[model samples]
Target: EFFYENIQGGDFSQTKSFPGLSEHSSNFTLYYETDVWGARLSTVYRSDYITDGDGVSSDADEIGFHATTNVDFSAFYQVNENLKVTLEGINLTNVAEEQYNDSADRIYNVTTSGRTFYLGASYKF
Candidate 1:
């Protein structure tokens, strides 16, 4: 259990304070791997944000949620028992647009980011 608070920035007539918003997020991760391959899984849930004062928030506080999972598929081979090679793929699920925002007491929330994938190879001697 945790908490967070934020204030906007800009000219709001008398003062430059954005709406104060708070969010709570919880997450967990699990990992599994073998000589041939390995993988990791994780997820995060964020609670809705509430506005502190009226007419102060650029975007009204709203409920938000996000999650992500990654897996790496690798193959290893030994050359003369001295050299080896491995291949990996990061962020297999490629989750995108996970964040949500409430824009001034609206019914819908805004989302941010998108899924991404990456690959690489390595050699050991």
Candidate 2:
């Protein structure tokens, strides 16, 4: 549900950290359910860190993630006792997955997958 740590250690040559290791990351979730209705919502978050690197150097095009967040949701409803319907969605905020040169302002690359959704039904015997 939550996490916090300072991943500050890397190759003996430097006192920094490895690639793709973000510090201070966390997750939170909420849920509700009833005899005929159920729903859930969740959010995941990660703090900024030295995301990555092409070649080990101070200005050698370092990569880092700018503290991004993602939200998702799902819900279900029971029809009678033998049928049910469901719905779900992802990336509700559409927060593009991004890459920067150390800081967030210095945008190096940007990409967005757009929001996604799904619907379905099931029957039980």
Candidate 3:
């Protein structure tokens, strides 16, 4: 169990409709790795913003889960004892909607990136 809170920037207005923004975020991750394959499970949650001085309020909340799996195909491979290649993957679960905010009179949310791949090569000479 874990928890945290933070304050976000905001603007205030009398006729243009403005509100203060703040957010709280929390998450948990369980990971496991092995010689051939590995997996990780994670969950994230967030709270709506609390208006600073404005009376209005917004409805923006966030909650999501992600799972990632990796494979070490080169665990027992050799390329003539000279050069070897390795491949990797990131954000395999393709989680989305990682951010959210609700305050004053507006609500917004966004997701950055998901499901990426990486490749690497090494030589011993």
Candidate 4:
């Protein structure tokens, strides 16, 4: 499946919306499941947006600001009718962004947790 969002900037009372504010974003997912096994994968893509109170331009008009993409994966297994196990991985590609830091006056790479994994089990009463 796919999802999308669009955000517009405007003036509300005396407060103006931020420049970047993630004007557009999309998400996609693919999943499959069976009696014994299941798997799911998802990806997120976002358009370049402005930073609030950072005085930075949108990704289209400036350097340092840019769009981003990330991916995640998950799987599960059913050992029996009453029990199951699941495994998940987040940010599998370690996607990150580079932005201009006005204070530092240089381009810096912003990173997330990189890659992480989780294992869990469930039982039915």
| Predicted model with the maximum TM-score | 2
Q: Which regions of candidate 1 fall more than 4 Å away from where they truly are?
A: 1-23, 50-104, 107-109
Q: Write the per-residue lDDT of candidate 2 for residues 12-101, one digit (tens) a residue.
A: 222444666777789999999999999999999987766544333454435676778999999999988999999999999998977676
Instruction: Give the alpha carbon lDDT tens digit for every residue of 59-96 in model 4.
Output: 32222356788899999999999999999999898877
**How does each model score on TM-score?**
0.41, 0.75, 0.38, 0.66
- C-alpha RMSD for every candidate: 7.5, 6.2, 9.7, 8.6
Greater TM-score among 2 and 4 belongs to 2
Indicate the worst ten consecutive residues by lDDT in candidate 3: 1-10
Cα lDDT over the full model 4: 0.67
Candidate 1, residues 1-125, lDDT tens digits: the string is 22223534434322222233334557666666665555666655444444333333465433333333333343343433444454444444454434434433344434433344444445555
Which residue pairs come into collision in candidate 2?
none
Worst 10 residues of 4 by lDDT: 1-10
| Rank by TM-score (best first) | 2, 4, 1, 3
9, model 2: CA deviation in Å? 20
lDDT at position 90, candidate 4:
91
Please list the C-alpha lDDT of all candidates, in the order they appear: 0.42, 0.73, 0.40, 0.67
The best-first sequence of candidates by lDDT reads: 2, 4, 1, 3
